[model samples]
Target: MISANKLAGASSSDKYRQIHDAFEKTGRHWLYNATVGAGLPVNHTVRDLIDSGDTILALSGIFSGTLSWLFLQFDGTVPFTDLVDQAWQQGLTEPDPRVDLSGKDVMRKLVILAREAGYDIEPDQGARGVAGAGALRRRVRRSLL
Candidate 1:
C-alpha cells in the first residue's frame, strides 16, 4: 500500500501532487515522507539533477549510522566495532543489522535510482557487500584492545 518511488515528477511539488492524486484515486489515507527527516531526496532530486546535466552523487545507506560510520572507519578514526555499536544504539540499523551491512538495501536503492535515470539496471547488477557477517565479526574482534 505504501509506495516509495512509484510516481516521480520534475519538482518536489509536482511529485507531491502526483502522490496525492494517486492516493485520492485509491481512496486511501497515506503519509508521504520523501525528504522530511531522511536528509536526502533520493529519487525526485536525482531525476532533477540528471535532467539538468548536473552530476549527482548518491550515497545510499541504512537509516542508522552504518554508512557514515563505515566511512569514518575507513578513515581509521573509528573502529568497526564502535561503528556497529553506534548503529545499534542509535537505532539507525534494521532489526538485524546484517540486513544493512549486507549492502542489499543500498543496492536496491541504487537500482531504483538507476531506473529513474533511464538506465536498465537489475537489482542484482548492483555491487554486493564485500564484508559478510563473519568478516565483520573478525574485523571487530581485531579492533578490540
Candidate 2:
C-alpha cells in the first residue's frame, strides 16, 4: 500500500482506509508497482516530492485494461450489455460505472498527486472543481461496457 496523501489533517490510516474501502466497495483488486517511477520508497517519494509543494499543475495517466481483454474475447458483434456483464464478472468495475467512468480513479490518483505536489488536497476538494472529461469518460465507459 502507498501513502495516499500528505495533508496535515488526513491521517495515514485514513488514507489507507479510503483505498481499502474503494477496493472493497468496487470488489476490484489493485496491485500497483510503486517502483516503476519515483526514485524513493513509495511513501517517502510522495512526501519529499509531491507533498512539499503547492499548486498542482496537471494530472494524467492510464488505467487498468481489463476491458481490453474482454473486448479481445469477441469474434465480432459483441453486445454492449454483454461486455458490461463480463466486465462486472471480472471485478473490473464497481457496482456502478459512475465512479470509474467519472474519472474518480484519476481523481483519486490526482488527490494523491496533489498531496505529493505539496498541496493539502482532500477528496472533496478534488471533486469540487472538475472539468468535463467527456472524451476520457466515453472511452472508460466503452471499455466498461
Candidate 3:
C-alpha cells in the first residue's frame, strides 16, 4: 500500500528498495502508481514532474479525508461534533479524527511528503491510543493525544 508514512531511518535508495520488495510479493502485474502519490490524481502528476527531472521545491494540498470532510460538512446542518462524528462514521478521517485532530495526520502526511522529496524522515507515534472508542464520540476524544 502507498502508506501515508515513511519507514523511518530508510534512505531514499533504501525507500525505493523497500517499496520494490514490498510490491514484488503481490506479483509483477500488481503495479501501484508509486510514481503518483497519496491523495489521488495529483500525486500522479507530481510524480510525473519528478520523473521528468523537474525540481520539486515544495508541494502542499489537503489530504483526501480532509477534502471528504469538507464536502460532508455542507450536506447537512449537523453540529461540529456531530459532523466530525459523521466524518468518522463515513471513514473520511484517518481511522480516527482524534488522531487527526491531535496532529498525527499532519505528521504522517509531512513525513510521507518529505520522503517523496528525498529527505530522510523519522516515523511518528501519534496514533498510539486510537482504540476502544466503542462506537461513540467519547472514544474519539479519549484517544486524542
Candidate 3 lDDT at 120 equals 58
Ranking by lDDT: 1, 3, 2
Quantify all predictions' global Cα lDDT against the true fold.
0.57, 0.52, 0.54
Steric clashes per prediction: 1, 6, 2
Candidate 1 stretches with Cα past 4 Å from truth are: 1-39, 49-65, 71-82, 131-145
In candidate 2, what are the lDDT values of residues 1-145, reduced to their tens digit? 3432223223343674686578789978533424212323443455555546644466454432443445566544777567767787877755665554455554555555455556665667656434666776797689679
**Tens-digit per-residue lDDT, 1-145, candidate 3:** 4443323322244665576676788665323333223435654565577778877787666544554465557543555677777778887666767766665555555555555565555554324533653565575456553
lDDT of 1 by residue, 66-97 (tens): 66566655655766667877777887755667
Measured by lDDT, the strongest candidate is 1
Give the residue spans of candidate 2 off by over 4 A: 1-44, 51-57, 63-76, 124-145
Q: lDDT of candidate 2?
A: 0.52
Q: List the residue pairs that clash in candidate 3.
A: 36-44, 37-43
Alpha-carbon RMSD of each model: 7.9, 10.0, 8.8
Ranking by TM-score: 3, 1, 2
